[model samples]
Target: MTLFVALAVLAAVVSFVCSIVVWKLGLRFKLYPQIRERDVHTRPTPRLGGIAIFIGILAAFGAAWLVSSLGPDRFSLLTIVFENPAQVLSILGAALMIVLLGVADDLWDLDWMTKLAGQFIAAGLVAWQGVSIVSLPIGGISVGSSWMSAVVTVFAIVLVMNAVNFIDGLDGLVAGVTLIANGVFFIYTYLLVQQTSPFNYFNLASLIAVVLVGALAGFLPINWHPAKMFMGDAGALLVGLLMATSAIAVTGQINPAAAGIEDLFAAFIPIILPFAVLVIPLLDFGLAVLRRLRAGKSPFSADRKHLHHRLLDMGHSHLHAVLIFYAWTAVVAVGCLLTYVLPVYLGTSARWALLFIGVGFVVCAVITLAPLGRRKRLTVAAEEAPAAELPGVDELAGVPETHGPVTAEAAPVESPEPPNGAR
Candidate 1:
């Protein structure tokens, strides 16, 4: 745990510094493209933050490799790396490929077919390097033939990548949401490792989660509302790829029968946690795809009808919409994590975890729907008001009603047009 903390800190510092450098270089070189009609932000912003994030992750992995080579035998994290150099290298290589593909798309606006081809190649590379899912935790069922395992793993990775990228419409939405989700996932993985390999208490999944948490923490200051830069497609896709990898590394490798986890629900946590953490992104992605297909358009076609867009249309402020995402992510991710934790540590029934989830859902529903209720009330009040008492259009538009001629300074400035998409 101490070593892991040190590595996370190292990654955070490196990513922070790199982000600053990238931001400056972007401005100096005029690397950002013009703002599109569908973009939420007013100004053109750089989208190369993913390159810095990837560098930070790479640095952490490199440091881990060095420590594994030089450190003493007792450091189990070192040993894990030493034992699986091929797998580690493959993950990094795949990440590099993804970053390059994303950077090109960010700069050139590549077609969907081109992007999909790259995604499949990267996913296939990782699966071929033995990151493929071998079995399910459910009743110790295996995933069947090697070919089947590879196909399933590749498909899963691609699905997660797109799902995550679909929600990149808002500033800091992906970074903050990933931070919260991965934080909970890190805890779950660490606890699972302690139960399964008590002596070591270290694994690939937890390492990936912690490193991601650090990278996002470092990048988020710049990616926040009124962002200096966006993570763009590159960062979003990279995050999704790593997240899917981490889930597979932990979930696929664990043998429920050997781990002595008898409870059926407990055994399923490995499968459930990833979905629980990614519920929002997955939901948005699914809806978008279905909507586009119904309209006879490409599933990957861009639009302003995303869930976040709906929140903006419902009258939620920019900051409020982002916070709502964070809140729901925390509620769902932590709720699922507790289901695994309470049973193992407190000998309590899983029903307690269910109760927590139920209460959390109710709270989140209220927060999410509150804007719509407020809007409805405002509309009703406006409709019922007497015509004479109601302010005229000029007054409502910030022009003061006066008998005297208004000065230029006192005249209402035309409000800037709202961006087509939600922030």
Candidate 2:
């Protein structure tokens, strides 16, 4: 346990250093993006943040490999029956491949279909590794089926990839949120591993999550508000894929019932944890698709209609909007933790916690909707205003009467009657 934790910490440090190097490289290579209409930032920012994160993940893996090779008794236990470490390598490899795909898209503005194809292929590779959902459990009840697991896993991977991608709107938004999500996963999986028997490979999953969190933390300094660099599609997609893979690996390997909770729906619980952590993005994805379809537009078309965009429109600044999302993600993530820790008999606590979550959601909703509500009221008031009392363009124009000639203050107001005459 100590060795694993140390490796994770080392990986984070390496990842941070890698981020700094990458930032320098970006500046020297001139790999910067221009300000676009949809962009939230005002200045040109360098990219290639993905390189740093990738290096960090690789550095962590190298340590893991070295440990396995040196201490055959300790690390070799990892290889004895589960083949978990190798599976982690495969998953990481898929993430790296997707990162490359993202980099290509970032640099070249790759076509939407092309990007989608790349994402699907990346997901396929991970799915191919046989780290798929294999059953459905309702609370503590198991409805085991291999085919259902496969479908669910594929769907989850694809959803998570897009979810993280969709929410990568502001500087440090995706990176920060991802780090938090992964951190939660790491803690949960670690605890699970500690409580379970030796055969449990939960530790490896947590290790991956920890390494990812470290990499993102390292990159955050460069990617925060008034960012000097952006992670581009490469970083966003890579983060998403790793998160998705980690969730599956952790949940698939553990039985929730082992925690002494009698899950009436055991299979559903594993799936729910990841979903809760990612609720904001996944919900936003559904909204995006529905909105695009309603507008008679391509579902894949990019636009400023995301949840963050709506928040910005409602008067939150970029950082505020990002933080708003961070708060919500934290809330949901903590809720997940509590659900896991507290047994079913303490159902009342979970219910009250959920009620609080609902209130939080309502506050966000009101903030989002209140401005439009005010606008509507203002419009209605304007229509009902007495025209005689309301100042008109002619009345406010400050033009002197022609018969009286120009007053010293007005000088006949020669500026085309101020067009429409309303002030």
Candidate 3:
């Protein structure tokens, strides 16, 4: 745990410095593209933040290698990397590939098919190096064949990457949501390791999650509301790829029977938690695809009708919409985590966790729909209120009406432009 924390801190420091440097360089070089019609932000911003995130992750891995070489113990924090050097290298190589693909798309606006092909290639590369899902925790079901496992893994990675990228419509939405999701997942993976491998808790999944959490933490200061730069396609897809990798690394490695997880819900948590954390992104992705298909457009075509866009259209302030995403992500991810936590640590039933999830869902739903109620009330009030008499031309020409001078409170406040340009 101490070593993990150290690596995370290192990643965060490096990422923070890199983000500032990147933002400055981007601005100096005029690297950003013109604001598109579908964008939510008003100003043009750079989209090369992914390069910093990838560099930060690389630095952490390099530090891990250094520690493994010089530290007293051989298998201290590099257990996974030492034992499976090929796999670790493959994951990094795949990540680099993804970053390049994203950068190209960010700069050149690569076609959907070309980007899709690149995603599959990167996913396939990682799967080939043993990151593929070999089994499920439910009833200890294993993949029938290696080919099947690779196929499933590739598909899952692509799905998650696109799902995550699809929701990068709002500033800080992806970074903050991914940070919260990975933070919970890091805890879950850490606890699971304590139970499954008590003596050696250093594993690939937790390492990836922690590193990602740190990277996002460092990048988020600049990526927040009124962002200085966007993560672009590269950063979003890289997040999805790594997050999917972390989930796959741990989720399939555990066997319910071997791990002594007899409770049905507990057994399924390995499968459930990943999707639970990603519920919003997946939901948005699914809806977007369906919407485009129904409209006779490409599934990967860009649009302004995403869930975040609706929140803006529904009158949610920029910050409020981003926070709503953060809130729901925390509620769902933590709630699912609790189901596993209560049973393992407290020996309590999962009913408590289920209740928490139910209540959270209701609260989030109401908050999400609150704008509708406010709009309805305003509509009713407008209908019931008597119309005011129009002032004469003289009054409009700065002459005082018989009603007297207009008070500051009575003056109409001009609404500012909606913060909706970042993508």
lDDT of each structure?
0.83, 0.70, 0.87
Candidate 1, position 288, lDDT: 94
CA shift of 302, model 1, Å: 1.1
Writing each residue's lDDT as its tens digit, candidate 1 over 124-195 gives 989998888888886568799999999999999999999989888888899999999888899989988887
- Models ranked on lDDT: 3, 1, 2
lDDT of 2 by residue, 50-117 (tens): 87788888887777766666665666654432355556656777888888887877777788888888
Candidate 2 regions off by >4 Å?
A: 76-86, 138-151, 198-202, 252-267, 344-349, 355-423
lDDT of 3 by residue, 1-423 (tens): 888899889988998899999999999999888888888888879999899899999999888877877754765656555578899899999999999999899887999999999999999999999998898875558887999999999999999999999999888999999999999999999998898778778888999999999988989888887888889899999999999999999875455665453355766776788888999999999999999999999999999899999998886889989999999999999998998888879988878988998999899999999988877766666567676744443443334544556677677434466574456
| 2 or 3, greater by lDDT | 3
Instruction: Provide TM-scores for the models.
Output: 0.93, 0.79, 0.92
Pairs of residues clashing in candidate 3: 39-421, 40-420, 40-421, 40-422, 41-420, 41-421, 41-422
Worst 10 residues of 3 by lDDT: 390-399
Candidate 3 matches the true fold with a TM-score of: 0.92
| Best model number under TM-score | 1
Order of the predicted models by TM-score, top scorer first: 1, 3, 2
Q: Which scores greater on lDDT, model 1 or model 2? A: 1
User: Among these predicted structures, which one has the highest lDDT?
Assistant: 3
RMSD of each: 2.7, 7.8, 4.5
Name the lDDT value of residue 270 in candidate 2. Answer: 55
